[model samples]
Target: MKRVFWRAGLALVIALAFSSIIYGTSTLKNMQEQKKAIQQQIKKEYEELKAKKDEISLVYQEILKYDQQYFEVQQVLDVLETRLTEKKTEIETTQAQLVTAKEKEDVYYKNTKERIKVMYEYGNTEYIAVLLESSNAMDFYNRLEYLNKVVEYDKTMLRRLEDIREEIEETEGRLIIEKAEMEHTQAEALIRKNDIENIRVLKSQQIAAANKKKEFIESEIKERQREEALLDKKIEEHIAAIERERQKQNNNALKFKEGFLKWPLPGHYRITSPFEKREDPFTHKIAMHNGTDIGAPNGTPIYAAADGEVIYAAWMNGYGNTIMIDHGKNSSGQHVITLYAHCSSLVATKGAQVVGGQTVVAKVGSTGRSTGNHLHFGLKIGGAWVDPMKNTKK
Candidate 1:
């Protein structure tokens, strides 16, 4: 009975040790899988942000064009106003001519009427009587000639008055049309002037807003640089400590691997700028791009790509609003570290164990050496910089 009990106890101890090994392996695998997922998410978010940044930039350019157009429209309005004034003066002159013509026409008509009436009355009486009562043929002939001349002169005057009246009516009709055209032109000019003014105001406001945004981006970059510096210092110390602990525990067999991790953000983000040996966008000089630029908008959410412990969650130099996570160990015993820079804000705290696909960072404005709002993602393997794109598959 004593032998049997001892054997049972030994078997139980062996079973427990095997179980522990299996559980530990499973936990490590889960963490690796989580990290890969987070990396992919980060990449997606970066792509989305980049596209949006481009769109916003285009809008800014369009606003500038609109300003120029507004100025041109204002000039056109001025020309229209001058033309309208000239039309009004011309209309006034035409109206005066019409009034003068009408007055002359009325006077001519009154004189013609009186002359015709006298001729008609005298023709039956005194004119004819004088002709008939003449003492000689010469006297009668003279009176008849005088009467004929008078009648001819009166008929000419009446025809002249009729012509003048027609002319006055035609002139008045033309003046009325001219006046209507002037009023219409004036009204159209007023509308255009008002539209130009409104457009100018709107364009001015847009320019001001763009200027303000530029200023804010500059300030943010400076602050992010300072924070990144501090965070880098902390990260270095933390990695060193972790290395020491791993060696002491003889767990150096497991380590982080480069080119095997995934993105940390969601969405497809284009790398407007990349991490490489290239010319700087602002400086126009050859400089090392320390991190990859993934353009995004302000307030876009950021996620973790893998399961890892937050080693440093703070700002660093040249990296605005940064976060650093330490993925424990890979096959080579080297530590894996992921850095997120130029974030708007940090959601996870240092020492917190974050799961893959979890929101750990916030999208923010460009914080370092950046022209716009974007996130700079960096991957460091065993304290050495590595290309983040190499690890991304999709």
Candidate 2:
């Protein structure tokens, strides 16, 4: 029809510059393998969080050495129950002094059996009838000095009742050897309180096996943080498909100026928030504030709001140190991308091409899901997102 539509417009401009160099070399090879899988998932959750904090601090120092030996076996069973109540009150005062020394040896055996029944009923004929009823030689020498002082006072009261029955059987054999040594120290303090309750039940079963191996290494560090959040959503879907194929090959060298785009933060910025339904300055909620922010400071810089090429720089996630670019299509066919997000670093590199207001690339930060040193920016076109204040540049 017209040289077959001019070779299908030169094969759609060489298939849009070979799909923008294969989506910018597969988005810088999946963001350098997602930064080496987030440094091997933070070195395996820091060695399983230091081996579960050193196995719960050695099972809490072996349950404090079995609770300090069960408080020294309850202080030796309270001193063997206070020496078994003073050995049962010294065996009841040695059995009340052996019943008062057998009641004073039965009152000296009833006065020595009534003086041996009056000398066996008149033994020496009552000692010659008391020397012929004494009334002569000075009353028979006073009846032989009163019968020899009544037989030496009944043999000194039977030798003091056999020495108080041998001192009450030697004080009841020393109070039965101190009540068998207080019942053998209360049976060795109840066998050392049952061997300290079996060593506190085997140290409480080794502190429940160290809290079940620290809950299985904290569920394998939450499954490696869900595989590093699916590798940050596969590096943000390959940097949004290489910024939509480098904005369809910079849709014919876009150069727009007055309101077509570009004021991506150069001098005195301000914006603070605009894109749309506000709020969410870091999940304050509401929602759709997709881009715009601004407020720069800590490091500031940033630029490239148009020309574009760098299909993405690096760490993205919530958009920390990002980049993106690709500015291209306009009139209606939409494509133009932009996005600068929380930066604070990355000085244009990914695919590098930049231009617009002289690509400074990135700086202003507060990193990902930020809240302070702003700059968010963001934009897009064919792949959706619209109000970057509808083409920026107020």
Candidate 3:
């Protein structure tokens, strides 16, 4: 009976051990799943933020292009004005010519009227009487020739006057048409001028809007930078905690993954500036670039790299709209912090535990001291700034 009791006790112990092992395996699996989910969430959020930023940037650029077009229209209007003035001068000259032609026509008509009246009153009777009253045949013949010559001369004068009148009328008609054309041209020029003024006003409004957008974006960027810095601090602390925990556990097989991380945005966005100590674009002086700048449109969505708590989600001075997340320690005891700067808004909040590939952040904008829309991602290690790309997983 004692021997039987011993065997039963040993079996119970084996059963307990098996149960413990199963429990530990399940817990580890759950943690890994959670971590993966967090990473995915971070990536998703990063993409969304980038998209928002890109959109805003595009709008600003469009506004600038419109301004250029507005100036061009103004130039065209100026040319139109000059053309109208020249056309007015031409019209005036045409009017004068028309008047002169009318005067000449009036004179010709008057002379023709006088000749016709004289010829009508005298009729053919005068010619016949002059011929009969001749002293001899030779004289009569000579007198007839002189009478015919006078009638022929009068006919010639009448024909010349008629031709002059017709020519004058034609010229006046042509001048009238030219004057009408000039008036139309003048009207068109006036319309063009009005259009140009309208365009200028519209462009001015656009410029103002762009400036306002830029201001907002800049403010947001500064804020993001601060948030990122804060997040970095938190992440470092978390990493250190993880390291301590790992050391206590003494797990020698676990290792942290390492490589340059891919940019959160999908498009092949350009890096206007790199992570390093460099000169400022506007200041043109030596300054430290706390983060790498990735150019994109405004209102683009931002994402997190791994699972962690959001330490900040607010406006930072130079980072514009920003988001900072802290990823907990890996098996190897390393902590990770990711910062997103120059955002239009913050979708996530402080103390919120976010998952990876989630839309926890927004796009980078020209919020503070920025020339355009772009993301400034910063990483930190042990309360010190580190290259983000270097720590990112491949």
- TM-scores for all candidates: the values are 0.41, 0.35, 0.38
Cα lDDT tens digits for candidate 3, 144-176 = 899778768767765765676566567557656
How much lDDT does each candidate structure score? 0.63, 0.70, 0.62
Give candidate 2's error at residue 137 in angstroms.
9.9
Give the TM-score (vs. native) of candidate 2: 0.35
RMSD score of candidate 3 (Å): 29.9
TM-score of 1: 0.41
- Best prediction by TM-score: 1
Which regions of candidate 3 fall more than 4 Å away from where they truly are?
1-143, 241-394
Please give the RMSD to the true structure for each candidate, in Å. 27.7, 20.1, 29.9
- Model 1 bad stretches (over 4 Å): 1-76, 120-126, 129-150, 206-214, 235-394
In the range 1-394, model 1's lDDT, one tens digit per residue, is 2223223423432343234345545555554555455455545545554554565576667766765665676666677577667766765776676677667767877877776688687767767786898889998898899888887876787677677667767766776776677667667756765775676577567657655665565455555554555555655655555555445334322433445456665684778778687776666777666567787777777777556666666655556566776666566655556777777778888657676566555565677545787777776555566677886544
How well does candidate 3 match the true structure in TM-score terms? 0.38
Model 1 deviation from the true structure expressed as Cα RMSD, one decimal place: 27.7
What does the lDDT come to for candidate 1?
A: 0.63
Best by lDDT: 2
What are the clash counts of all predictions, listed in order? 50, 0, 66
